[model samples]
Structures are given as structure tokens and as C-alpha cells.
Target: MFHAIPYILSLIAAICAALPVLLLEPSRTQSAGEIRLVHLLVTWNPAITAILLALGLVLAARSFFRLENRAARAALLIPVAVLGLGTYAARVNVFEKMFAPLPDPGFVAAHQADFLSPHDLVLGVSLGDESKAYPVGIVAYHHIVNDRLSDEPFVVTY
Candidate 1:
């Protein structure tokens, strides 16, 4: 039982860390009750994950000294490795890193009919005498556009 405790705790921590990110989309569209539950999970999972990882590390360190077989020791190391990696991933915000926001994107001028399909969506902004259009297709991928209009800096995001 003691030998398995670290693995169990590490697994639980990893799953908890991953759950909020995985459920983000569904949570947004869920009923109020479900959304509240997911909101609580997303808000608290990080701290919970950290605590679980710390406890798992302690247990793994304690168990390491008691293990006799080489293979058993090697197997015991797996959960510790996973806990370390998971902690790093959680700290780094791996999902956001994977789809990092665009930085200072540029724009091109072209006839609307040349590039845009008639049915496509776009975001339009007007500031004083300046007007700009951002195709939804482009902004959907990068999630942000930085630009200046009327000498004022602003960002557009979807």
C-alpha cells in the first residue's frame, strides 16, 4: 500500500491539473450549475495539484529508502518523474504556451473581394477618421491583433 501511494497521488495530481484545461470549452457552454462547478475546479485545481505533487514527492522520497530490488526502485522513480514533469507543465501553463498569442502582427492592404469569401466574417473597428477590418479567419488563429489608429494604440482579440 505504501509503495503505491506516491503513484496514486501523482496520477491524481496530473489528472486534476489537466481536467480544467480539457473541460474549458464545454464548461463555457454548460448549464449554470455545471459552469459553477467547473469554475470552482479551474480556480482551485492549481493549488490542489501543487499540494498533491508536494505530498507525492515526500512519499516517493520516503519509499525510495525502503525499496530493495533494482527494478522496483526503477519503477518507483516513474511516478516521481511524472510528478516533476507535471508540476513544471502546470507552472508553465503548457496549453497557453502551445497556442501562444501573436505579437505585433502586420496587416496587408488588398481588395476585399480578392481575398475574402462573401460569407466569411470579419471584425471592423473605427477610430475617428481611421477604419480597419480584421478577417475572422486570421484573428481566430492568433487570437489578437495589435495596431495603432488615430495615433492611439489598441488591441483586437476574439
Candidate 2:
């Protein structure tokens, strides 16, 4: 029951998303590969994650009512507690996501190099649309150029 309910809920969500993907495309103002707002809203990973999490939570709560043994409740509570904490974390993060858009997938895929600690290395490079937060005022005592960030495969000159 725990597993089956989540799958059913996800199926319903997919159907909901599909309606917008098909029906809403004609109404969009932009042309080309522009991402539609409906696309962004309905297909956002967080939205789907929230749906799945809610369904799982409901299932968990349902199980709690059916449980008999005290030990069974204790075992179930561990996962339930973790899910609760996870849901809380996801909720807090979801609002933050809408403001700052996800980086372009092409930019991310184009340059998929692993990030290294830049402060230690006087010379380091980061390519693609991947972002690495480097400590300010801690960069190597050398030349640094922040303007080269938009040149295709961006190279942070430092």
C-alpha cells in the first residue's frame, strides 16, 4: 500500500502536467526554444517532489492508524520523522528556487568539468555554466579577471 499509493499519485501528476504541455503551447507569446511558464511551473522537479512526498506522507499517516504493536510504531516513526524533516527542508527551499532560475541545461552539459578549490591555486579554471562559490579576499595573491565569465566556455582568469 505504501509503495502503490505513491506510484498512483505520480501517475495522476504526470497526467496533470501533460495537459499543460500539450494544450498550453499555442498560447505562449514567445517563439523558438523559449521555456513556457507552464512548462516551468508544472515540470519543476520540486513540484513533482512535493507531490510524491505528500502522497508518501499521507500513506505513512494512514499506516500509523492501522499499526498495532508499539515496536511497529517506533520503527515506522523513524521513516516518518525523516520524511517530515525532508518535507520541511523541501518546502523552505522551494520558495527560494522560483526567484533564482536554474542555469541552462545546455550550459551545464556543455562544460561538465569538476570544480576545484580556487583560493589555493593561483591559476584555476571553471568551464560551462557550472557555478562554484569561491571565498572572496582569499584568492591567491595574483592577477584575477572576473570579466571573462561569458566567453562561451568561461575561464575565470585569476
Candidate 3:
């Protein structure tokens, strides 16, 4: 039972660390009332993760000294390694992976009738005689699009 302490602590630490990355975006889409609850959790995730990591380390050190068998000592390394890797992953900016900016996106010209939906939202940009429209659906996913209009470079972001 004593040997399980480190692993349990590490598991909790990893979950706390991962919650913000996994839930932040989904929370944004929630209703305003529920968003406040989610915001609280997201805001405190970092502090919670830090505390859990500290506790896990302390418990891991205590367990290491208490275990006498060589095999049991080696088993403790598993949780230590998991905690290390989980901490590294938790520190990464997950948005950098999700929202990849588009560069030199291809466009096709069309008549007004080509867009069947009258309610479609688009981001329209005009530079002198050149004009472009980017659909909001695509922009919402990638967040950023790089394009050139009349040889002038521009970036559009949601």
C-alpha cells in the first residue's frame, strides 16, 4: 500500500495538469453561466498542478527511502518517470498544435450563386482592385491565414 502512494499522486498530478488543455476550448462554447465554472477550473489548473507535483515528489522521496527490496526500489522509478514526462507534456502549449496557420491558401473565384447558404459568415478583405473572402468555418479551426493581396502580405485571424 505504501508503494502505491507515488503512483496515485502522479496520476492525480497528471490529470490536473491536462485538464486545462483538454477543456478550455470546449468551455468557451458553453453557455455563459456554465463558462464561469469552467473558467474557475481553467484559471486554477496551473496552481493545482504545481501543488500536486510538489506533493508527489515529497511522497516519492519518502517511498524511495522506505523500500528495502531492489525490485521494489526499481518499481518506484516507473511513477517518477511518468511524473517527469507528464509534467513536460503539461507545460506544452496545446493550442500551438491545434491551430496551425495556413500559408498561401488556394482560392477559387465564383458567382454569388455558388454559395448556396445565405447565412454563411465570411471574412472579406479588399486591397485596391483585389478582393478575397474567407469562410468563417475554416478560419475558426486554423485561427490564422496568411495571404497576399496585390503583392502586399497580410494575415487574417479569428
Every model: Cα RMSD to truth: 3.9, 14.0, 6.2
Better of 2 and 3 by TM-score: 3
How does each model score on TM-score?
Answer: 0.69, 0.32, 0.55
Error of model 1, residue 72, in angstroms: 2.3
For residues 97-141, write the lDDT of model 1, one tens digit per residue: 766677767666657346788778989888998788888998888
Q: RMSD of model 1, in Å? A: 3.9
lDDT of each residue in 35-98, candidate 3, tens digit only:
6755665566556666666777888788889988888888877778777766666666677776
Local accuracy by lDDT, each model:
0.76, 0.47, 0.74
Error at 7, model 3, angstroms? 1.8
Q: At residue 95, what lDDT does model 3 achieve? A: 72
Rank ordering of all candidates by lDDT, starting from the highest: 1, 3, 2
Clash pairs, model 3 backbone: none
Report the error of model 1 at residue 53, Å: 2.3
Better of 1 and 2 by TM-score: 1
Task: State model 3's lDDT.
Answer: 0.74
For candidate 2, lDDT tens digit of each residue in 19-89?
43454445556543345654564446356646666866787677667778677655665555544444444
Best-matching candidate per lDDT:
1
lDDT of 1 at 5: 95
